[model samples]
Target: MNITYDWNKGVWSNLPLGVKVSKLHKFNALPVQFSGSYEYNFANAAVVPEWSVNLTVKLLFPM
Candidate 1:
């Protein structure tokens, strides 16, 4: 499990990026992994904020 928070308001007046969370899981001994993450942006107030999710699969080969 991993979590991150980014506060760029101090550096940039219009920057207010919020948070991101991610998780990883192993499927098998074959070196396969599943990972997902969620991100949010807080800079825009006029627009509705929605959570975005991303997923990816990883495979590794060992010699």
Candidate 2:
């Protein structure tokens, strides 16, 4: 879990609050892992999105 906040004077209300949540999963039988995240912005801006999401996969090789 994660949380973020930002203050911008140029933006509306002088605040550009944001929140993010993420998760990670790992398998014991396999060398594969997965992770995902979601973010939301609570600022009235022209170039910012209200919500966003991301996903990632990783493979671990044994040496």
TM-score of each: 0.43, 0.45
Q: lDDT for model 1, on a 0 to 1 scale?
A: 0.49
- How do the residues 7-39 of candidate 2 rate in per-residue lDDT, one tens digit apiece? 454444223344444444457755776766765
Q: Rate the local accuracy (lDDT) of all candidates.
A: 0.49, 0.54
Per-residue lDDT for 1-63 in model 1, tens only? Answer: 223333654332222334444444455656666666655644443443444567777786658
- The stretch of ten residues in a row with the least summed lDDT in candidate 2 is 10-19
| Candidate 1 accuracy as TM-score | 0.43
Off by over 4 Å in 2: 1-9, 12-30
